[model samples]
Target chain A: MAIRKRKSFFDIINEYFGDVEELANQFEDMFMEKPSWSQKNCTMEPLKDVTVTPKEVIVTVDLPLAKEGTIEVKPLDSKTIEISAEMKRKIRFDDFGITHHKGEFQRFYCQTRIPVPVEMDKVKFNLKKGILEVHMPRKRGERIPIE
Target chain B: MSEITIIEKRNIAPDATMLFGFPDVGLVGVIAASHLIEELNLEEVAYVDSKLLPPLIVLHEGLPHSSLRVFANNNILLAVSEIPIAADIIYPIIQALIDWGKNKKAKMMISLSGIPIQERQDAKELKVFAAGSTPEMLKLAKEKGIDILGEGYMVGPQAVMLQKCANMKIPALTLLAQCFYNYPDPEAAAEVLKSLANITGVKVDIKALLEKGEEIRLKARDVMKRTQQELSGIKKAREYDIPLYVS
Candidate 1:
């Protein structure tokens, strides 16, 4: 006969802390309105959407003028990502019928904190039609021995 | 004070068809409206003024302009906004526009917008759908070979416009093209404009719109960002929900 053991107290504590940390991160991301970087000097933050599922977290970014080869996605930590992409050409404010702003932008930058812990080493990304999509698997819960 | 006020810049044709293009999914409406204004050489006819609007003014040619303005030619009036209308004010803003259109004895009102679709990037051809306030309008869309959206949750200004028009017995139709949910999609905008031509019997060259798709996407990023903020406030994701029909 095979016997199944219950989870240890240490495992329960670890999972409880992990879930609380994830919830706090999610609340912060949801409520924070300002971009992590400064907006001066014609710098722009690309619009992004993050969807967290049980298995993975998917992030989609709108990089309007970006070329596929110029995009860079890096994980700053287990819960944070940094994305930057250079535009194919500089876009001037005057090009859009605005003359008050006297500068142009050649790139988009953003740093966002993911609401859930993810496997940073296994992150995968693709840029298509000026949109960048990143998929990261959720970190597996640690296993503990049952006495 | 009224929640929204329309200030007329010039006398407009009373029987013209009115078109509305506000910021929404894919930024489709704004792009299509801008193209229509350029192609048809529509001139400013009126503008909306509201205290509820954010404290912002747009400058063009060294002249101050309302963030939300109306343009018109002999056959049509186009109402477009440079910024996304906040969710709290969408109801009043759309109400005021519909009331003004009704008072002007406009023949019909049409809203050009987009419906978000999953896997939009993989779509080779986008399809346009229509929802009408009346059966007569639905028949018109059918004759024009546009699919009818029988059931779905609609968000933003167009959703309010449709409801108000229905209540006022004004003929209105909303044309929605399938598009990416969170990206500026000029291709979807082009598709919506093509559908507009069929329904309104108005034609404009779309070659330029397609050629400058990337440029438009770039220029519209700021507005799209603001729109993304307002969309969250309005619970715009309800547009994707499956509705429970209480028949």
Candidate 2:
């Protein structure tokens, strides 16, 4: 075994500042527009099927871990609906034997533009097994007239 | 020359240099920080790449005496205020905070978070945790009745900030409260904020949270109704089967 001599104070300072500068460069790269995993606010799982009935357009959204409240639906047109929801929550890192505690998070303002004109006034919503369902009634005038 | 400005609202000297976490992770530290900034009348000292891909805003404030920079983004505002656990390192991101913190001569830093929990789902009692630079910090943690957990993986910006601070030899601690994993839990955030106010001696008005809670509650209920209806059609069907094994 050979004994290794300690580095000089100047060497340590140089190394420390050098690492800091490298960290600065790394920060620049991290802040850059990163693709493939950018979205951080809301996790959206688009429904498997958005069925349009003669009287109503049934829009289903896969929202697991969703609360019974916090969904907002706005109708843009006879064929378009905008959906927004928020889920505010807190998490203890301890009970889970965790070290970090992310505080006072209200997962709100998750928005989605739905393709289908639904009646805003008569809109219906439901939550089951972490899934969200929205029923938008079709506009009366949009229906085909039968003589 | 790096441009710097000083903000003198009051002579309020901050004991801990806080790395204000994102909006919705452990409990909404960033939002609380925003509220503090508003309350203290802090001024913007710098802007670091607010127009990056995801978009973030960095502001500087030397409160009463201490100088520190706060980095935030529109994404943080637009986000659901949840802890981001995306499996990306963003190591460079943490380094940036270090650089920013060092520029202000910050001796110690704190990161805030909210963890999801099943117990106390309805009740509110935020537990504080600490991960410091040395044994002295650990002693402080014991004095505060705060547990110092040795290990666990943390998510989002705070996680990165913690690593950076530790690596840079800056005393750092992460405070978090228990929260629901799968729902918008404003009450939980409120609890965490109250604890934070107590810890940092920052005054926080709960009026905004109450108002926001009502608005969000109504929306959550509506969404839950719709979700239930959609899932009603899904049912499980099982058939009895006999397995054949080869001799």
* lDDT over C-alpha atoms for residue B129 of model 1: 95
TM-score of each candidate?
0.86, 0.44
In DockQ terms, which candidate is top? 1
Docking class of 2: incorrect
lDDT minimum window of 10 residues, candidate 2 chain B: B232-241
Indicate the worst ten consecutive residues by lDDT in candidate 1 chain A.
Answer: A34-43
Q: Candidate 1: misplaced stretches above 4 Å?
A: A1-43, A97-102, A142-147, B1-3
lDDT of 1 by residue, B46-155 (tens): 99988888888987767788999999998999999989988878888888888898888899999999999987877889999999999999999999999999888998
lDDT of 1 by residue, A1-147 (tens): 989899999999998998898788778867867642343645568788888988999999888768778888999877789998887777776777866556777778887788888999999999777778899999878878798
* DockQ for each model: 0.48, 0.02
Error of 2 at A2 (Å): 87
Error of 2 at A84 (Å): 13
Clashing pairs in 1: none
Instruction: Tell me the tens digit of each residue's lDDT in model 2 across A23-84.
Output: 77567644653321112543332332366777787765544334567776676544456665
